[model samples]
Target chain A: MEGLQTVGSALLTLGLVAVAVVLSLYERLDLEREIGVAVVRSFVQLAAIGYVINFIFGLENLGAVALLLGGMVLFAAWTSARRAGDVPRAFAVAAVAVGVAAVATLGLLLALRVVPATARYLIPLGGMVIGNSMNAASLTLTRIRDDLAEQRPKVEAALALGATSRQAVAPILRVSLQSALIPLIDATKTTGIIFLPGAMVGMIIAGADPLEAVRLQIVVLYMLLGSVSIAAILVGTLSYRSFFTPRHQLRKGVSG
Target chain B: MASLKIEVRGLGYGVCGTEILNGVDARVPDGEITAVVGPSGAGKSTLLRAINRLIEPSSGEVYLEGVPTGSLDPLELRRRVGMVFQIPALFGTSVEEAVLYGARLSGGDADPGRLLEVVGLDPSLAGRDPQTLSVGQQQRVSIARALALEPEALLLDEPTSALDEAARRKIEELVRDLNDRLGLTMVFVSHDLSQVERVADRLVLLADGKSVGEWERGDFFSEAGERARRFIAGRL
Candidate 1:
């Protein structure tokens, strides 16, 4: 009955969508259809997930919760792997990176009782951690792969000088990691002053206390930072090996 | 007359079925400069890399000092057989750092000052930034870097193609001088027949990824070497 009332109230927010559509119509911004589609898709997706999450919260079994979270991590890994072009075995790299980061961060949160051991808290928070880690994993993989190609002469120069593949790429790994982490770093830096995060705002909209919302949002930010760092480091460490042979020679066709 | 310092035996390297070095063979005599000369796309550079195992050969083995290089640890092999590429690809920003890079990799040290002198650069240049120097000086720094490994043999892949003619002559002199003074086995690659004649004790003429003819410098320039004549005539 409460969920039904919330959905009824949310339907009144169509006027908010119409405001953007009206601006697009007047200025011919070419975004009216995209806005409409995004709103519809997000509404449908969130509404479906809401009912599913409601049902999971009722059952409250640990195994079932773990299975759902594992599915999210797998999809995140697969999506990130595809985003990284031309890297061989990137799927396994992404899976290990994103999966480990999520497990470590979420496991710690649950173990510390900072968040309750329930599907309601776990599913939404897991989405935030997995989604951010996935972005970091893909960004690091793609940047490292491309940077290796761009820095081929430097890398090959190091290799020819008898430096191991690890030593040769260690410099590049630093730069790629910085590239992956910069976005999360900036968002964390400006979180409260610039804008309230979506999770915090959602909590407030659901009638939770603002201070309580801030507490969860801070945890979300720190979790993101830690997970993104782990994912970036792991993806970089794993992907650089693909560029070299076991003899430490830069493999052919890796540049492309 | 000296024992062969490096022997490349029927080496073949291909990429995606396009053969880059096909059954190439060359013998680099000890303490002498052997120039691999070829036209563009002749796999001269590829042949040089095959010796260092920078580009692993598909069908053959390279022997260093009578030992099959494949049987040795590759990092140790590379340290002993250093290579200098065409672009003077210096790694670190500081000249001293670049010169000492190989040394550091082997957990050893070489005097960057002495190395700079060996490659015809002032020791003071070591303190300067390599990127700020002229291309010739930078190439010399790269050569110094290779020498810092204390390699038994040095492979130079067109070490002066990116330099002007004067710089090229200076590098040629430095290479010849290194051979004379250090007794380091020197194998250099170039398409310029004139450079090869000026620098090499012996020559390997490559065409279409194969060693078509190998000759002492005396025979290569003389009239009796008919295959050399054909290559010079662009008839091969």
Candidate 2:
């Protein structure tokens, strides 16, 4: 295939975005402005990331890679925290969840020798893991908060019966974590059957060996499951504490 | 006379700079049903919750059988002083499971059938889902669940407020039976003065977040203050 120039590539993507904008406008969806903003923001953000990744990938030091990865997790946490709404210190919870999940998953992979501990291997993989984990944290926290609020009487009844906060919120936590994992589980179950995943397809388009791409994609999928589950669990456990007082009283008005 | 089962001294709860309960003091004697009654927003429920530390008092303390509520582990305190809400909120999938929930959490044993029977429920209802039961039946299941904890006291928050006349009578009879037979210390929040008249041995009158007066049933009906009289007259 002939290589397209940067301007040509940009215009091609812009053309696709224009199609979406036109459809939204014709449908009176009121999403045309949001689509335009998202397109612009994504373009700028991806361009900045491209430059940053280029700089980091050139460096051999682990410290630079860690710093960049930490920044990504922090940014992802802040975004997720917005969805967390009324939970006190929601941003801290998100940050801790994302940080813990990413570190634990990456550490396991390194210990298993599934992936080498190098910036080349760590940055992209860590970014994907952290991004999904952030989503899992936010979804679990928000859902748990909503569930707790909705089931306040049930929880209070449990607490009144001598159940601890953990005991009282167990059902709510279970449902929240399961819900948070559904998207990732669905994607994993359907991978390569309904649609080719982006990572594998990207590798294939870039001329990598198809078998190697599939193997890498499998590893990525498994890693995502682990990271998301851990993130959900941590977020659910920590965020629930904020919903009740030390005296086991359910604090009202915690809903977003 | 019964000893003081729970003491609330200067008990106050403030939320968002507004006081819900302020410096309210009262005594709930053992082996009797004491009803906290007043006009709406009188903090009757708040007082009940504070007894078990479910709503931590902003100032002052609750003494449950001599131990300050603040000094006890909340779970332990709650186990010792269980509560039943106006609307029964049962946990677990089935009535049996709901009854067992407290026992399981507390690492104790309770026979669901026996507990249900004690609360005037059919043992056959044990396997049924609590949601499938009538509101009154569910309330009985709620009482059975609390009883499984073997609490020294049971706080009832408008326990019969949602029931029909028949169910209300059933609950009132049950409360009286439990108090008379088991010598249970019961503190209930009630808006229905007639229901209060039927069951309460002593009454605590609250208005504007303070304890306006405390009286025995006969005294309250015949010798109440102007504020208390207005409450009784449904004018407050």
Candidate 3:
């Protein structure tokens, strides 16, 4: 009877929190209609995630875990490419690159005992790294595309003057990739001094020692930095060819 | 005949079966300012684009100095033939950067001061952002950029169409001066007949994707075909 009461109380509390979130979003974005849609989507997604995570924890199979991680990477890549706009097969490429890079880096850290190999440690940490890298890749690709469109005349003139496609877009490509890495660099530089990052705070709430939490957070930070940098550079370089042809002319209908 | 700088023979371009330039045949003489004049949708710009392979020719061939342009590498072809657009298109944070972009890409060294001077711009404008310049000034900076490669032929598509009369005269004078000083082969495209007369040594009049008439600049005004005359009078 007491356990049932405790569960009932927890349900009430969760319902209230959901209401509060909806009300807050409504107030902040002036989006009354969006609140209901957002709440429903969040509920469905979170519930689905709960089931999947529970299954993974129960099975604890390496292949299953790898498949789940791969799916996340593919989704991240698809979302990033969608955001970047009109890249020919770029989303698939970005997905494979970000997924492989993020998962491999985080997996190595786990194997090296830098972070715990438990599902709790591995899943969230891998997700965070992959998510951040996806953002970096998306931003880099978008900026490069926009810069190429805006600076087309200069690019054409360059081509006319004996420049290959890579040479033609070198200036904008350099600037775009550098700008994409700035946020990750800044976050790393200011990690502890500026704020207590989510991982450290979460660890503390879960009753870990403060020093231990801080050490793990540092590892996560460095891992993210490495993963995102590599993803941004690779995605930027590979995606550039999609914008032009083998003959170095801008591919018609590719530009948004 | 003196070597033709550019020869477009029966060129046509289409996208998804929609033709843009149809059967365009024209010869641009060496060291002559040949103006391609036509109204909107007459394929004036498309003709210029075909010459440098900016727009692929679906049916015909373009020869640059007797070598087929389609045979040469596009980058190498572009290096010898340069294009300046209708609107002054400048990129980068500063004028010098935008102008030098072409030279840097081509692996050539161009004196920014000399290039700016040739375009009738003050050397001090070099350090300033091109976005801050007026329309005419930006166009001059674009001219400087195109000239950076010392291209054998320059293609201008309504280069002064976006400027005021005062700016127009300045650009016109600059074009004339560039032609005389450098003996550059120029293919100038314009909708304005008077501007064509002022600049062109020879004229190729286009209408509905076809070359309607060809004549020397003076003769084009006097002995032009009825369709060409009507086009000039804005009657059709």
Candidate 4:
């Protein structure tokens, strides 16, 4: 019984997914097939990513790391831009935000010698920061666009009273940024109590010392907080101008 | 009082394929109320907004004090020609903050209490949240917010359409007082011809995005063109 060898481990994972499918059928929930498909996709994608990361780690070259990180940022921006529907140059805007924040944060960490300047350390840390900041940028941009659309009267009222575009949308901008950061803030506040975050768990599973894992986890959390804050602010500030015209008129049809 | 404060020449605005204002031409005298009266979709609001550059005209020019609006910084222009929307759209949480919002943005010294007093509101109401105020009071706060800028001209878009009779009369009195005391040029969009006649020193009739006719307050009833007459008689 060797405690589930490789083949047995694979089947055990499949069996766990089967439980959800069975329960879904018993409860008449329509998500049985979706659950199955999601499980399979996650397994396949993670396996593919594992191999890619292994290859990337073996490269140990600065160019390869930079190219990979750039690709990740481009893809992240593309996904984030979907949330900012109808906003002009949304992809470019998100790319700039996520790219700048992730780079700046990682650069600072590397300069401080907190993270080594190698593919092994940089790739994972940059990926984590970029991915979280992407989400923040997407949420903030989408929220700001929607708020500007819904609150046209409020914005124009401010404009009519000689407020600049920046002044006109300031309140909504503040709210959007606050809303965008709320999820990260809450997760950070309840980190140990609610659940073990992914980075710490991954470190522990890799046989690192628990105390060392906790320290790395703290750095990851702080990095995410700083990077996401920058991302949200950049996205929010850059996107508001699109809501107005050259003559300072509020654009009524705020769409593609 | 007779100098031209706002001159709209061949102003046109179109959205997509539909024309909102088709070459509107009119002049607003300084220190006088110019009532723009038209039927629904006559581009009354568009014309007023165009004056303040809130809605850019597709082809035309708006001159404030004989200077083209295009040449000035829009923010600066907007400060000079303040506007009030149909609905009382206050920005900040409290009434005092709302009144001060514009003034602060324009880098002006805004005395909330004095602005409130000028708008006929009790100075104590400054501390209350604008959301808690009655619609009429909110509308007054809107006016005070605009006046805080100490603008040379004022644009009102159906300022009383949402209010009751008493509230409407109060706003009308406030408008007249502001005009007389400040000598501010005013362009007010209204559907109510009676109110226009009662408070406006001059009247401009717009229909189908064009200025059909204009007259002094005394002559509008007798000398309005045929189409404006139909609109006045509720027959258009």
Candidate 5:
């Protein structure tokens, strides 16, 4: 009963504070509609997620867990592809690739008992890694596509001058991959000094020791760096080929 | 003996089963500039691209220097035959890097100073970002980059259509200079008849994806085909 009351009180306080922050930001930054939509969607989505997670946790079946994870991946992929307007199919492939690679690598760490495979630990950690990788892949794919479109004439000129499609598109590929990796590098550089990331703070709030929380955060950070790096590289390389035909000419339909 | 540099026979392309270039047949000569002039949507660009296999021909073959383009590795073929575009398409942040892109692709070293000089650009402009340069400067950089491969043939698609008058003159002058000095075999597509007259050694007039007539530079303006006359009169 007390636990329910505490959760209810905390929820109300959080809701009020969130509303205040959104209102203030909207007023100051002129992002009113965006803030409104984001807040409303976040509230509804979080509520729905809370119920679904409660149901999943109650079941505690490994198959159910796997199914939920798959659904999460698909959802992440779909969202990323939609956000990346042109090359939706390629973006979808990139998202799936990143999600699978990141989740599998992180899952192995947990499966190998490198990290405990508790639902509380695994689900959120996997979600964070997948989410970050999805963002990186989306950015990388979009940037590469845009770069290719913008520099198409130059690419053609290169092809005319004996450069393969890979050689022709190399400049854009290198730039996009580097740009996609920037956030991961920045976060890694600034970790613990500039910010205490959510996972570590959340763990501490959940009654974990500070030292343990920090240690787990470090693992999460490293996992994210690895996953995103792999995602960016794979997405950039594969997407370069996606824009070209088998004959190594830029495909017309692939244009943005 | 005059030898053909590029031969396109019965080339066609389409999307979702609609033909874009239909039965395009033409031969680009080894040491001359051939201007493909047509109204918009007449497959002028497609025809130029077809030579380098930039656009896959749905039902035809392109022979580059007596070797079928289809049989030859596209990378090797493209390396020997370079293309320029309507817009200045520089990829890198700086002008020098954009010029170096082709050289890098071909695994050749770029002499930036010489390339800039050939294109009539100031050497100081190399360090500036390509986006900061005028359209004319960017186009010149693109030309220089294409030349870096020391290609036997050069394909251009409406290369001067995007520039202002001064920029257009610069490109026209550069095209003439390159042709005369380097003996670069050039194939350029354009809708502007005057520009074609100024740059082309020969003109291949296309209408509705078919070649309607061919004329040498001296006789192109006096050609008698109705479509050619209409094109010259800007009735196209």
Candidate 6:
């Protein structure tokens, strides 16, 4: 009966998804198949990850934990790299930016003993940091490419008048960094008032103390803010070079 | 004999198997206005860019005053050879800021008021906002901005094409005056042959991405210059 309660509740959430599918059908949205597929995929993926995470939790080895964290970073980088179309060495750039950002934030967290050195705490927090930073790095790379291409004439005018590549692109870099960080900035600003964040909601559902859940959610939000900014700044600094020649000429057709 | 200030020797550029400038050659005389006249896709702008190392030529070298441009730092070369585009791409907000941009970048200094006067704009125009000015006025501002760098040569890429007839004539007069009074070496790209005759000391014809013929202004449209005649008639 105890285990059945947990299983029963999980199965009940399917009813919420069923309602969404029903609404899609009523509206003639033609999205019922997509909704069903997405729900099934999410269920299978989460179930697989749940089993894998539980097994790692039992082992309690740091190496296994580190390996899982590395895999998560690689997957996050790959996912973000897709958005960085036509950025030279985009995968490498995204990986380095996301990897460094994740490590820096996660290392500081562990060193400070903010989160316990267990799979339960580390995996979720690390995932949050990596996921947020991936979005940022991806945005920065895309903006840099698009803006540079769009502003080629102004850039070349500056270059033609003895301006360095750095001087010419400083404006674009500023805008890209601002764009990459704004989403996270807004999320941070509206955290508690606008919406209760997912981490805290998950903790509450798992029956953790409400106050404990709030405290953990605050730490998660702070980590995202820090790591996302780091990744964005890093991507901007690294990717601007790809748009110019060594002689400071704006490369031909840099935008995707 | 007039010395050649800018020399394009077999200049070529191609990308992804399409040739833009195919071993083009031209010689721009010092302290004179050399007008490059051609139809669309003639590579006139590309050749002008190569002279200042703005666009590196793939197959040949460009020399400025007999010094191989490849030997100079690109920034120094660009400073010595100013460029004004077809559109008046004025950055920042006001006219004065646009005028001083090159000077600021190169650590040189020029009075905005005087540069405006040099470009035939009123001194007070410097204080006005760039958006408030006409397209012709904006082009003058961009030209003045280039002049602030004290460049040895100026590349004008169809500078008057966007202007009305009155403004076009004014800019044409300005180009002629600049060469006559200041001895400024200018390579101007133009579509109108009459404008070329009004301002140019020499005419360089470009077609099929190469220089097909060249002549002094008097002979360009003269009866003896059959090649030039055929070119004007769209036969060459």
Model 4 TM: 0.92
In angstroms, how far off is A4's CA in candidate 1? Answer: 10
Window of ten residues with lowest summed lDDT in model 4 chain B: B223-232
DockQ of 1: 0.76
**Per-residue alpha-carbon lDDT of candidate 3 for residues B129-209, written as tens digits (9 for 90 to 100):** 899999999999988998998899999989998999999989998999999999999999988878887888888878778
Give model 2's DockQ, 2 decimals.
0.77
Enumerate residue pairs that collide in model 1. none
Candidate 1, A1-256: lDDT as tens digits? 2453766788888999999999999999999999989999999988887787888888888787788889888999899989986788888999999989989999999999999988888898888889999999999998888888898888888989999999999998999999999999998999999988999998888889999999999999999999899999999999889888999988897762
**Candidate order, DockQ descending:** 6, 2, 1, 4, 5, 3
Off by over 4 Å in 6: A1-37, B233-236
* Residue-level lDDT tens digits of model 4 in B21-121: 99898989989999998888999998998898887788999999899998898888988999998899887778989999888885667899999999999
Q: Candidate 1 vs candidate 5: which has greater lDDT? A: 1
Alpha carbon deviation, residue B82, candidate 2 (Å): 1.5
| DockQ, all candidates in order | 0.76, 0.77, 0.53, 0.76, 0.59, 0.77
CAPRI-style quality class for the chain A–B interface of candidate 3: medium
In order, the Cα lDDT scores of the candidates are 0.88, 0.88, 0.82, 0.88, 0.80, 0.87
Ten residues in sequence with the least summed lDDT for candidate 5 chain A: A1-10
User: Compared with the true structure, what per-residue lDDT tens digits does model 4 show for residues A80-173?
Assistant: 9987878877898899999999998998998999978998888889889989999999899888888887887888888888877887888899
Candidate 6 accuracy as lDDT: 0.87
What pairs collide in candidate 3?
A160-B78, A160-B79
RMSD of 3: 3.5
lDDT of 3 by residue, A1-256 (tens): 2233453555565677567667878678566566658767887887787789889989877677777778889889889989987778778768866976776797689778886666766677778888898998888888888888888776766665567888878888889889889988988888889988999998887778999998888888888888988888888788888888888877776442
Report the C-alpha lDDT of model 5 over A60-128, residue by residue, as the tens digit.
776776677777777777777777777736656766577766667777787778787656666777788
lDDT of 2 by residue, B1-236 (tens): 57889988998898788898999999999888898988889888888888888777889999987778898998898889989998898876899998888889878889999999999998999889889999999999999999998999999999988999999999999999999889999998988778888999988988878998888888776655445766656743
Q: Which 10 consecutive positions of candidate 3 chain A have the poorest summed lDDT?
A: A1-10
